[model samples]
Target chain A: MIIIGGTATNGIDENLSKIISVPLLKVEHKVFPDGESYIRIPQHITNQEILVVQSLYPPQDKHFVELLLILETLADMKNNKITAIVPYLAYSRQDRRFKEGEALSIKTILNAIARAGADVLIVIEPHKEEELSYFGKEVKIADPMPELAKEVSKKVEKPFVLAPDRGALERAKRLAEQLNAEYSYIEKERDRDTGEVRIKNLPELRLSGKDVIIVDDIISTGGTMIQATRAAYEHGARKVISVAVHSLFLDNAYEKLINSGVKEIVTTNTIPQDPSKVAVVDVSPAIARKI
Target chain B: MIIIGGTATNGIDENLSKIISVPLLKVEHKVFPDGESYIRIPQHITNQEILVVQSLYPPQDKHFVELLLILETLADMKNNKITAIVPYLAYSRQDRRFKEGEALSIKTILNAIARAGADVLIVIEPHKEEELSYFGKEVKIADPMPELAKEVSKKVEKPFVLAPDRGALERAKRLAEQLNAEYSYIEKERDRDTGEVRIKNLPELRLSGKDVIIVDDIISTGGTMIQATRAAYEHGARKVISVAVHSLFLDNAYEKLINSGVKEIVTTNTIPQDPSKVAVVDVSPAIARKI
Candidate 1:
């Protein structure tokens, strides 16, 4: 297998080395003044199975475009098989058309990626699993939340896993099961028009005097997490920690999380950061065997 | 005069009513899941002097693109004159070409807005004055920092304006003079490669037991303000406040500032928010005469 890593996937270089003997190739991206982008794969992979890893975080379009360019380049190079590992798929939120005349943009983007020459696609805890049909060949990765929670449990005594909202309760429960800890979720009501979220069932959780870890799949605005952490602290959680699979950490999310009573934040290498002091687990090894 | 308010400029609606008799118009934006955007004006704007008030805050590209699309649509509608009131211009940090072949992206974006049909462009204390040339427009709005400072003075007691960085010191001094308050600045060293900034001269300021207000043109990442607030608290500031002409509080910046010991974060209606407490001081009476 020949591995091609995008900018966000650069950290995977170390992890890939531990499991695979294949050489990891770096894809170069050059963005132009007119907002045009060009991508180049460094190694020759003709007739070879290729694994390309990229995270479609913010500046989402730009990164997604880069990935598209790479897939096109790889396909033109006649690579035998191409697998795209998009840890944070950018358009996952648009799984359906909420209004008339709006394109099923998520489907469109997926089709674009598939047409650009991806034989297989991998996404982590996508917003809606039904959308998996959008991808021609889908490979879903289990949430790394369980692994992260277990890791946190070893360091902190009396740790509990917290899901910021009900949508994430199952993931938190799984993590709790792994760590043999208690689990709970915040009941949230979000106003779609304004993007405002209100926590309703937060005060019901028994959080007093316990070390809590708020777990979620992604941290986009960090607004939800910040509010949840504050509520946890108010409910007497001695220290609140936040863990996520993909730290989209959009905007000034990291700073906001840090300031919002969160003692520490742990996330996977799904999204790269300078101060990412958490377990960097690779789904590639598990993925490689299946592919 | 016809008023066009962008999302951020919504706060200026009250002031516009007091100054002008014309009805205020709104530009609507629709963002697709695939990160594509569309914009439309509420009514016909043919041959009218249109002033668009928009603050380019977080999800920076989304807001910037929405502004651009509005400009394009208005131009297509043959508006007599178009003026963009951008209180907080995003991408101001990338004013210069740090690397060869790199786009002066900010300039390119400005030119795109101009091409989209802006007759005049108004900005509040742009990162650099010379950037005005990039707009290719006939009218420009320089620092309204002094006007904003006067407003702050009326609200606070013996407030001193402190520039978060040396680059902003001149504006701070201008505000200090207008408010009859002391002025100071922190020297900053920025990493050219990563766009990370570090404050070097923060410790030298003796803000102990004094009410300190940090003033700047724009707040994007909020890192500088966070540092300044921390340094102020360490130096014994009784209370720390922050004011900006354009609060392009990107991401979760507003929440971060509030959590970081900012007693109050006051910003002009340059950007609209539920938390926005200050509206732009209409220099329109003065500005209208010049145009």
Candidate 2:
């Protein structure tokens, strides 16, 4: 098997190779003065399994174009067994049209990806499962929650997993069960007229001296995580830590989360970032199991 | 025939509708919080001629993604006779690989555009003509030098056309012939080892009271144009004007060109910009002729 990394997935290619024991294919990604993207794979591979590692993070559109170019180039070289491992699939949030004339972005992006000649797609915790069914080709989803739970267990004492909102309750419950710790989810009530949101937690259970760990699929903008951190502090929790599968960290979100009193932020190496600042645990073990 | 304009080609849609006398389709292009592009045509397009006008300029990748989304959406809607009218086709410059393993971005982009379901393509002044034949589908190239020359004739007095370098001499000659003005091209000698460039102009030609117009296909960094303008000034040109098919205007390029003594700059409505400042001459007339 050969591993190819996109522009953003620069150093993770070596890490993936270490887990899977595959040769890495070098790709030269170039961006012109006009903001157009170009990529070149120095060698050609035929009749071999190829794995493309690209996380659709910021500059998602550019990375997406580069991904398509790589896929098409591989197809041109007659590589049939191509798998795209998009850790954080952009456009997964807009799985459904919110309004009458809204475009379902996820569906369009999926079709584009499939048409660009990816035989199989392996995504790590896509925002929506129903959107995966929309792709006509083979798809394998890798869940890193178990790995996240293991990391959480080693870091904190008497860990209590908390979901920021109801949408992530399943993730929180699974992680808590894996760690043999207590789990609870917060309810968000929004005043439609005023556009105000209130976070509600279970009144019976107390979080006084427990290390609270918040688990979610993605941490974009960190608004919900910030509120949840403050709520945990108000409930007299000893420590607060934020854990997510994908760390988008948009618009000063990392700083905002830290300033909001979260003890630490841990995420998988799905999207590349500074390792020292944001704790990026490896997800290659989980990915290696599937391959 | 139905014509639709993207975010960059806003006002130009109405102008095309007037020239070609076709109803314009409305497209709602939205960028989601997670940086995903969404585009909706609002109404279903059936068995009719469809034309989409979009320019791949700054934010080229996003516009390219949106263009693909629009094309794929049209395909899903079963629109067969879809034509893409990209006034400024990005990635046209990187038509071929400079190195052994470099990606032919234009070829990949063309294939992507075709797969996304464009049956025909219409472009104005793409950087290279040879690359257009690589597309399996039909392609139409429109040259609006006569129109740009007309715009220049009205703005300047006793105009003298000057090509930035040897490559653009054809454009300068055509525009000069149309305007019935004197024309000259700058000679560039590059040091093979050092890769340094020197611009040379004829010492015999005098431009003491003539308006000098420098014509080129694209004005990327404004370095060549600045040098050409300086050379024109040294030859005693009274006023200097710059003309291009596509205006990329990279990093302080507009300010650099203005500061270099160009009186005014004129470009076609290819790349989107403020009409009051950039002097975007309409290309609807040229497109209307092709339709």
Candidate 3:
């Protein structure tokens, strides 16, 4: 098997290459003066299993177009197999229409990827697994939560896991089980019109005299993380660590989270991550196992 | 047919609405803080023919995604028919791979639009008519050349049409015939690596003692137009006019062309043209005929 890393992959593809012990193929890519993406698979390989690693990070539209070009070009090359690894699948949150006559953007995007010719699709902890069904092919998820839990355990001996909301309680439960600790979720009521949220209740444990870790699938604005950390400190938690699979940290989210009194920031290298500021965990081993 | 205009339509849809005498539908669109596009079609219409007028201009991918969403949603709403009008089709210049192991970007993009549920696709003067074959469905082109020629005839008498290269000689021929004038093309050799071009030879008539109008399908960066205008002046032409169907005028192109001794800049309102600087010709009547 050979790997081809897209320009937006950050460093996850390199990690995957190291873990899988496979050679990474070089791709020559450039943008024309008119903002058109140009790519070429310089090496000649026919009937070989190929893996494409790309993450739809910021500027998602441009990255998505490039990914489509790569997939289409690889499909025409008569490859034995093509697997697309989009660790941070942008637009996954728009899996369904919230209102009348709304478009399911995630569905449209995933379907287009399948049409672009990917034999298998792999994403890391998509907003919902059901969205992958639109791909119409074999789908796998690289869950970094277990690895994140392991990393947290190495730092804190016994930790209580807390989910910012009930929607993410299961992730908190899984992490707690791995650490042999208690888990609970906070209740949050969000005003759709105003985009404001209010935490309804705190955990039963009150997190008193205990180290707490908050887990979620993604942290876009870090708004929830900030609020969750404040609640943790109010509940008498000794230390608060915030962790998410895909840490977007958009528009001062990292600084806001840190200012909100987070003891440590933990996130997987799903998106392009800054390890100096956040403890970046590697999920390549888990992804390699699935592959 | 009811018209639905995207935000990036640049008044073309309104022109289409006026020409077709159809009521335009209301669409509310916004972007989330996380940079996801959200759209809501407020009105309900079923079993009515729908025309979607969207121009894939600058920031092309975002507009393309919105087009897909609109088409997919309209398809689900049981519309009798859906016709997509993309005036300035982006990525059309990449119709085919110029080198081995390259992606046919235009084909992938066009195919995706069809897959997104556009029943009939209508584009305006695409780079190559052959690229539309990738749509794999009913297709129509709303050529604005005739309308442009008519408009130009009203402005200048006895225009000598000249194409920058042999590739666009056909366009020059059509424009010249509409004005009852002679047509010729310049020979140009382009350096693929540096994207530089040099005019090898001027027209046989030397363009002496005649008003020259240089025509092309699209003018991006205005590099070719500036060079062609200089060549026309060097040949002792009385005045030079630069015209194109889609006037991108990117990166100081407008200023550069005016400084290059162009008497008039005429272009269709294909890519959000600044009407003050260039003589904007309307092509709505031409598009209306096909609709």
DockQ of the two-chain complex in candidate 2? 0.46
Estimate, for each residue in A1-291, the C-alpha lDDT of model 2 and write its tens digit: 799877767466677888778988768876766677778888867888888888788779888888888887777678458898887788888787665545667776787788777889988888878799766899998878778877777789979999898888888888888889898887888888999998765686589998999988888899999999988888878999899999888888999999999888889988776887877878777777668
Any runs in candidate 2 off by more than 4 Å, and if so which?
A44-47, A78-80, A160-169, A181-212, A226-240, A251-263, A273-278, B21-26, B42-48, B155-170, B180-212, B226-241, B251-264, B272-279
Question: How many residue pairs clash in model 3?
Answer: 0
Model 2 lDDT tens row, B65-126: 78887877777777459898888888888887676556677887787788777899999987
lDDT of 3 by residue, A113-155 (tens): 8888889988888888778898889999877777888888876
Question: Which of 1 and 2 is the better model by TM-score?
Answer: 2
Give each model's whole-structure lDDT.
Answer: 0.69, 0.83, 0.84
* Chain B alone, TM-score, model 1: 0.77
Ranking by DockQ: 3, 2, 1
Total clashes, candidate 2?
A: 0
| Strongest candidate by TM-score | 3
**lDDT tens readout by residue for model 1, A1-291:** 777877666466446645677677776666433234545566656888888888777667567656766776677676469888887777676566454323344664676578667888877767777787877676556455555765677666778778888788888887788888898987878788998877775557888878898887777778888988987887779898887776666667878888787887777666665565445545445444444
Model 1, runs deviating above 4 Å:
A32-35, A42-44, A189-197, A201-204, A276-291, B1-291
TM-score of chain A of each: 0.85, 0.94, 0.94
Query: Of the candidates shown, which would achieve the greatest lDDT relative to the real structure?
Result: 3
Report the Cα lDDT for residue B178, model 2. Answer: 91
Model 1 agreement with the true structure over B1-291: per-residue lDDT tens digits: 677776555555446545666677765666543355544566766878887777675555556656755675566666468888776676666566443323354665576567667888877667888877877777476556556766676667757778887788888888888888898987778888999876665556787667788988776667789999887787778888888766656568878988899987766655555554434454344333333
- Interface RMSD of structure candidate 3 (Å): 1.5
